[model samples]
Target chain A: MILQGADALIECLKQEGVEVVFGYPGGAVLTLYDALYNSQFPHVLTKHEQGAVHAADGYARVTGKVGVCIATSGPGATNLITGIATAYMDSVPLVAITGQVGVSLIGKDSFQEADICGITTPISKHNYLVKRAQDLPRVIKEAFYIARTGRPGPVVIDIAKDVFAATMDYEYPTEVSLRGYKPLFAGDEEVLRVCLEELRQAKKPLLFVGGGATISNMAPEIRKFVNATGIPVISSLMGLGVVPGDSSEHLGMVGMHGTYAANMATVECDLLLGVGVRFDDRVTGSVEHFAANAKILHFDIDPAEINKNVCATIKVVGDLAWSLPLFNKLVKDFAPDIKEQTASWREQTAIWKQDKPMTYKSREGVIMPQQVIAKLNELAEDAIVVTDVGQHQMWTAQFFNFRQARAFVTSGGLGTMGYGLPAAIGAQIGLPDKKVIVFCGDGGIMMNCQELATAADNGFPVKVIVMNNQVLGMVSQWQRLFYGERYSHTSLKGRTDYVKLAEAMGVTGFKAEHPGELEDILKKALATSGPVLVEVALPSDEDVMPMVPPGGCLDKMILGEC
Target chain B: MKYTLAVLVENRPGVLTHISGLISRRAFNIESIAAGHSEEVDTTRITIDVEVDDELELEQVVHQLSKLVDVIKIVNLTRVDHIERELALIKVKASKVNRSDLVDIVEIFRAKIVDVNRETMVVELTGEASKIDALCEVLVDFGIIEIVRTGKIALSRGPIAAKEM
Candidate 1:
């Protein structure tokens, strides 16, 4: 139907099955915002543009769909850069729509004009600057498609003010033709065979699957591959939940802050099969010595990432869904070459796992961080776990048995401190049916603690568990290790009572200092409907274990017992 | 190993700054850096050779180089199969007796005489990094005064170009 550009946009979003959008209004997008005022779709008004984009990111992480965020041009559009970069780095699907300066004022550097397209080119997967109102419907459809497909990432569409106001006929196309955008989603047969052959011939083979495997729904295939070969699996931080955490062969996470056995396997394995992992610097510390002697077979959906990081002897460019199955079939075909005794390998891994087991007996009076996470995992009712960066993030990663991909969302690459509360709000907005839990440390939570108001104001109910160590615990841990027992600038002193803060934000708040109180408060927090916060205070000296010293090799990990 | 690297990069905004920033961030030493337009106008080729510890580090250097947005292509042409070449001009004390011998040395190395005067001769040599070093070493006997050597610029063997994708 022929309609005003703003109304057409609203109709297009409705047609695309969008129920919620995270945004903040400004002058450039006033018409669009006004159109949304009476619309059936619910729009979340984030306090800041950064908050809006992050909320959209959280939504994307939970829903596995293209999250939509809107903002006006100039300062509003520029403010989305950090959020866009974060989403881009983590491969979160986001469609960001910005109201540009009027088409007539474009290139004149109008008061509200900023070339968001040019600015975000490097960070975004793809972006468009719509000069005409007629292009709005197709552009949004394309933006959503590009953002959600392939290696999911942020895509921006900047519509000029005039474009948002002019009359246009809206017809959302069923498909988009992007000349510069085509993602590879099927594996090459010959390469798959070579990888399989290599995997079969190796004495010890390990599969390192990342978030891509989960995004592409290749978990079943990964399980199949593991079952067929009995190969052990390790995951990157973002790659958690790709494999069932409770699996016997799961070697846990691998990287700077990963499990000892996982890092050891990466270093010493004869053949390392990487699926959907980018080999980030945190994952491959001292890249020169990383897998120095191993033959690597890397399979990824993105062509640009093929040789961008780790060297691959056999590179497969395809989606995980297609590549994993092809690999499974190829391994079956090459069963004759398969001969490797990994019993000894498994024994060594088991020995290390037993030597430095992750455990903590709750003290009679003090509520430990480990106990909180363990209890949360137990009573989560299979909730989505979102974490803020710090010691709490590490503890959550270590303790939670995440069974599904996208079940756990954390700042994997950037490790942004204030990511939790806003992200949880977004997650709740996206998955209204599921319980979204924000696990954050005191220091990290305070970074974006202001977002509690946004959550309560929007009525997006999320269970927030603040691990109150009362210091920048991760940094303090580092200082304790590297410095001369000096603690500086890590402690949060005289901060407002968090329970009072929650109350001020109109959400129920609870505090627990003992293990008994911890379980009871968590159960109560889980039972409450709206936004909630449960503070569990642990000792100041608590530390995350199985830690490798800075610049130290994988096998040189400081075992807790040792 | 002290290796020379030549990077053929896309001539675009912020390319050099991006490369330099990465070098600074990674703490990889840049012994020498020279950037200029190549045979193609829109393509800027940078020749940088860093003295580092191991071959694995060299691979990592190349990988990091590839991550830069403006860096269209990166080739570790030093250790791998490639044509390595460097231009060096040496102004040595060409005496009455050893003048002809210096000329012979220059001729032997296929060095060109770009400039010559009564008491000074500027010999320009283009060859592999080792070959240039050897030429410089040979000139030291004749009392080397001034030396300017371009860091090694290299291209892979035969018809293969560095894959930009």
Candidate 2:
């Protein structure tokens, strides 16, 4: 019944169903490492605390479960800040545990002692500093709950050294009671009625979906509403795959890199039905100019999100699962002729789609990124594709035809650079049966390339596809587009041999220089088992087209042909 | 303007450090902050009045606060229609010279004398933050020695609750 503090912590983690944790042990958390020596639970030791946290975040995002990370206090804990903030921005569930100084030495600022709890407070969903060993079990239980429930986010638990050494009879609590925290799931009916009335009266209605809708798995209902009412669906960067991009009613992604038709539709529509989206700046542009003509009807589970950015003419604070059904029933009852209005909208959208066709050219003797993406789609149709932030991310978005919810998880809001590999590892760990492929740029991959070791050690069969261009391709592309081609801080010099690096990390390495070699290398990476890295050298000049330059309108996008 | 913010966080260690660290890291000036748990859940309500340019900075602070691990929710109750309350125990000189004026001022503010000695009068008062400030300013003339004020705590007016609304 009684155990060492470190053993108790590990036991608590095992009870919470934590199969894998990403972390690096140091002086402050040495006891935990000692306990883990004889422990059964697996931990992926990352090169950096940042990588550890990110790997956990990736795991959380893909699995819809709480991702766990651990680090010693001081610099080790501080390094996790960026990763934790990244999770917080995108609403990923993560639980980060840090070792702290003894309770007696807490205020004295002893060696390796940092106020990690205070440092992580604003960035975490909730945090705890356990001074007494008796509090560890309850805090750990609460941390998991707080991290995973009601708009999931990262929760940090910083344990004092004394607590880790102290002995206590540990038992996990079944229920937690937090007076200050109680998030509402269902929306009010009166608000829903008002929203329905507005939808019924409107001629042109736009269904703007966000990541929240995808997370909630309300895409089926969203499709029903769009089909029944004939409203065109436009999604945010994070909202991709909520409404299938291939669907006739889908407007593709809206915002900076959005389709011309999607942006135009957002403006021309009379009623804007925003569902499960935060209306981020990249999507809205200037808040005053955004959806200027529309009377907005916002439906979200978070009440605070309503009127937070753009004001909603009729706000329905509830889950889309409930709201969409009611709206569908009301529209069917009130406007039987809604089909006629939708038909015209769909026809107009068709014309707009035809006008701006996404195209790319394959320079002879070189592997193009678009061609690689299209090839992966053909070969691995059902495989999960994850991408880091860069030109490759945009190219993947434009090329990949996603069919499932939670399939396209990227650091959209934060636009974190070193996101892909760890995210793919997380995705693979979360869905072990499913094939997880990470599409990362050379620059992005090298940022957190050390995670390759994490994947290799865990035996997680994650395929890392590196689109090597020998530069910070996205920023360079932006400079080419907007800054007169004077590339600054975008060039990545002395590119490391990715294959050798992969091999060193104890993973299978496959390299492709030509288009002909890509498919074989990709297949090799998929078949090799455990973790594999496939490096494909892309043409340096190739740019992610159909990009709306920053601070520019959607109409001003630079299409490849145009 | 320097504003006092009363935030309620979980009653766990590192919460205050988290709050103060966030303020310093964001380069925001914190005039004063005081925190402790309420009578309800193991929640530590912190009252921090920060001096910033406009409401935008405050809103940014609130957003940043919401992002924190331990911070559950934030309400700028100042803009909302609500009842604000603060408890301050002040030890003031109750000399014969300014005793009558102090008593008159205390009567108007509906304050109670909690402690009394030959040289000191510990006055306890509960009211809106600004009212307390005005009373404190008035009592400053009587040579106030020690002041312990429990920061602002608020409750929404009418049936429009934070959850239901």
Candidate 3:
């Protein structure tokens, strides 16, 4: 059938089962927007292009679908850069569509004409600039395919203004054939056998999981493997929710601010099985000292990640979905005495957990950030929680007891600020029945505070909790500890009444300053029907504990105030 | 250590920029790069020479380059038996008293005089990078005025294509 390029784009999106798109219209995208005017497809107009992309990111992270966003050229495309990078770093599937000036004006530096494909090349998994209308359908198909395939990341497609009005014979390809792009799904039998042999021989075996477990939807398989092998599991920040936080086999998150038991287990384990983890710097404090005694076995889908940071004793390059179940079967069939082999190691880790439980000082007037997170966790036990980067992010990771995969979403790799509010909006929109909450710091909340309007306009009942500390908590802590308290530009001055700001955006707001009034205010805000913001004033000097100093060994952690 | 890598990539706009941007972003300096169309219809082969201090640096560069979607395959030619060639054009200061001397040096190197003038003569030579460097050193006696050279381009001395690797 003959169709305009804009119509073909809409048809292709519908074919891909895309129900919603987050975007903001501009001059360059006028033709596309006009096509979307009376269409049944839902297009959410976010306040900013950044919010749109982040919203799409949140949607993708939760739904396991390719989140879609659109914006005009130039600044509109540039604004999506950080959000795209955030998705890229975290391996979220996203497709960003941008409108360009006419083909003739592209290199002329015409108004609103930016080389978006060039600008986003380094960040996106792949990008395209469609010069002919006939290529639009194929480009769209390729973009979605690339975005959602193995080791998923964002892909950008820029369309010229003239192409939107041009006509084409629409045909969306069902399969893509790229010589350079093939993902390995099955593990080598020899490699798996070698890994299983190592597992049987080792006494102190530890299972380390990361975001790939969740991305590949292998949480159930991992849980089964841990149960069958009786191996203790430690997770990276992005690996939370794969194994229930309360499970006996699960050690808390392992990293710079990880739990005492988790860090110690990493240092002392003799055989470490890393599934879907990159061994990022934060998780491995000092690569030389990280699991020095362990014979590491790594299973990951991306071959590039293999031996990039830490060398693997037995490397299996394949999808976790295939590898985890196979490993579980192998262990079940063999290694009958695996439970007996690791009994003493488990007993030792239990002692560590008991001796060094996470704690903080309790005071009368000042509300502790940890306590607030704990209270929120109690109230919203099954809610989808998103966080911005800061001390608050760490506190949430420390306190939130996630029970399901994809329950906790944050900017893990990029650690972008201003991620919480928009991401929460996306989650709430995508999963309307599930409760959504944003835990953001004072510094992060102010970065994209305008997203409150997006929530109110959509009538999304997302709860926003601001841990107002009046300072950049993480940087200030670093300065105080490393730079002799020479705090430069860390302290934030002036104040904006968050409750009034929430009210101004047509949402309910509540404030709690004292520990005594915190619970009541939180309950009230959580019970509100529409979007609500709860600003809890916290002590500015609070710090995230159990921090491994940068480049220091995992064994040398600063437990708390000296 | 100096390493030469032959990389096969999809022929598309902005791919070169992507490759160069990644190299610069990782702080890996490219000593020389030569790229052109390949036998395949929609593929281009780029030969890059990079200097690294250790094996880890080389491994990292390979890993990062492989992550790029456009990059199809990469092969390190340094470890294999490969034939390498570089082309050079040298314009030496020539006069009646020394023009014969320059001709003798050019004949010894089996080079052709592409252009000649009253004061300068342009000699074109193709050989291994080392040979080109050697000839340039000898021609300096005639007061070499200008020189242009292509970066090293290498091919494995076998039927196996770098892409097959």
Model 2 chain A lDDT-worst window of ten: A553-562
State the lDDT at A156 in candidate 2.
88
Candidate 1 lDDT tens digits, A362-476: 5668877877888989998389999999888988888898888888988887788888888889988878899999998888778778788898887888999988888889999
Model 1 TM-score, 2 decimals: 0.78
Model 2 DockQ (Cα-based): 0.24
TM-score of chain B of 2: 0.77
Candidate 1: clashing pairs of residues: none
All predictions: root-mean-square deviation over Cα?
Answer: 7.2, 5.2, 1.6
* DockQ, cand. 3: 0.62
* Sort by DockQ, top down from the best: 3, 2, 1
Interface RMSD of 2: 4.5
- TM-score, every prediction: 0.78, 0.84, 0.97
How much lDDT does candidate 3 score?
Answer: 0.90
Better of 1 and 2 by lDDT: 1
**lDDT (tens digit, per residue) of candidate 1 on B50-142:** 877776566667766764434666666665677767778889888678889988988998888887777878899888768988988888898
Q: Against the native chain B, what TM-score does each candidate's chain B reach?
A: 0.78, 0.77, 0.94
